[model samples]
Target: MLNVLSILIGLLSLVIVIPAQIPFLGIANWIALPFIVVGLVIGQLSSSNGGRNLCLVIFAVAVVRLMLGGGVI
Candidate 1:
């Protein structure tokens, strides 16, 4: 259940970021970071491979966002 919640939170973060304006990129990613962290922790705790995969995806998105200069102020 926690794994699912984590995935959902990560997905919600993606949804939140998708339509963000350039000026709001930093704020959007900052908001998303907690979701990503939670997802990763859940993934580590869960034995399911799918949960781990979702966490990987969340990490990838975070990396991309950072690379795009979105998550840093």
Candidate 2:
């Protein structure tokens, strides 16, 4: 159950991240970070690592984007 919830949250953050990929929209990723963190925490509580791994990947993408944008675009 927790894993499922984490995945849902990760997907939600992914939605935000997709749009944030647009130039000058990178700030949206900052907004999505909290959601991603929440998902990670929830995922950590579950027995399976799938959701946790998903969140980690999403987190990495967001962070890399942020770096490319120099924190803001």
Candidate 3:
């Protein structure tokens, strides 16, 4: 459950960043990357699910989270 929560919270961070127009957000964006990556790694590296499916899902979710947080989503 925490994995999904982390994903959602990461996405929410992006959602909140949407209205702001600061330059530092690009840097702030880097911070979120590890969280997404960790979550992805956890979901993929630990799950019995094949690495390909897990890696893809993790990468996709993380990128989407980044985009939403970066105002691209």
Candidate 4:
């Protein structure tokens, strides 16, 4: 429940232009990892491994998006 919410919030948190930003190899994007960890923790606390996987999947998608942008943002 909370994990899903966090994932949703993280996804909708901002609409930064990925192509417009590129510095230090997109290191700033790592900042998002914390949100992913939060989602992971919330999922773990709910005793739902499925939720954990769901968060991880979300994390993977985000990472892929950053990479597709040529690193991070």
- Report every candidate's CA lDDT: 0.67, 0.96, 0.48, 0.58
How far residue 6's Cα lies from its native spot in candidate 1, in Å, is 2.5
Q: Tens digit of lDDT per residue, candidate 4, span 1-73?
A: 7656654644532222232245544454466567667767877776446667766776676577678766644
Q: Who wins the lDDT comparison?
A: 2
Which pairs in model 3 have colliding backbones? 14-69
lDDT of 2 by residue, 4-72 (tens): 999999999999999999999999999999999999999999999889999999999999999999998
Q: Which stretches of candidate 4 lie over 4 Å from their true place?
A: 1-32
lDDT of 3 by residue, 1-73 (tens): 5445445544544443343325444444455556555545654544343433444454454455556656432
**Candidate 3 residue spans exceeding 4 A from truth:** 1-23, 46-73
lDDT, candidate 1, at 57: 77
For all the candidates, what are their Cα RMSDs to the real structure? Answer: 2.6, 0.5, 6.9, 4.7
For residues 1-73, write the lDDT of model 1, one tens digit per residue. Answer: 7667767766776776665436545567667767777777887777665666776776676667666773573
Q: Is candidate 1 or candidate 3 better by TM-score?
A: 1
After superposing candidate 2 on the true structure, give the runs of residues whose Cα lies further than 4 Å from its correct spot. Answer: none
Q: Mind sharing the TM-score for model 1?
A: 0.68
Output the TM-score of candidate 3: 0.37
TM-score of 2: 0.97
